[model samples]
Target: MELWPASLAEITPDLYATEEVESEDKEVVAKFFALGSSLTWYVVEAQKLEFGDVLFFGYVHTGDWNSEWGYFTLKELEQQRYLGGIPRIERDLHFEKKRFGELDLEQ
Candidate 1:
């Protein structure tokens, strides 16, 4: 699947655009996850770097105890693969924009 579509890039805010907003109030623009893993990413903002790569910032839930906000890149996600060489990460096409506080992170 195409992970970073033009439609997504149009909706996602540039990096640091939400810096003034409280964490809970930050709007999550998109969602991504590993096809067969518990890992998930809630993207809040993104920016194209000088090298022409997009960098994403948001909440990453690796597990119940390892969720945190940080930066990741398009290249990193594209490079991920499962044991059989299947692409691992995929964007959640059905995701709707919502505030961070509205998420049911407890799952």
Candidate 2:
């Protein structure tokens, strides 16, 4: 699936847009995950740079003990690959937008 699709752009707030909002109140606009792994990214906002690159801000879940909110770029996600060079990360097509507090973060 296409990450940073136009439809997503329409809904995602610009970078820093939610900085003033409480984490739980922020709206997660999209979800991405690594195939065959538990890693996940819950995008809350994004910004399209002048050079045509997109930067995303979200909560990243790397493991049971390691998860945090941070900024990531589309290029970074695309560059991640499995041993066979297959793209490892993919957008969760079935994901629906929701408040961050509604997420089952324990997963």
- Clash list (residue pairs), candidate 1: none
Residue 45 in candidate 2, Cα distance off native in Å: 0.9
Give the per-residue lDDT of model 2 (tens digit) for 38-72: 99999999999867789999999997777999999
Question: Model 1, stretches more than 4 Å misplaced?
Answer: 50-52
lDDT of 1 at 66: 76
Backbone clash pairs in model 2 (N, Cα, C under 3 Å; residues 3+ apart or in different chains), count = 0
- TM-score of candidate 2 relative to the true fold: 0.93
* Cα-lDDT of candidate 1: 0.90
Q: What is the lDDT of residue 94 in candidate 2?
A: 90
Residue range 8-104, candidate 1, lDDT tens digits: 8999898889999999999998899988788999999999877767899999998787789999998889889977788999998888999999988
Clash tally, candidates in order: 0, 0
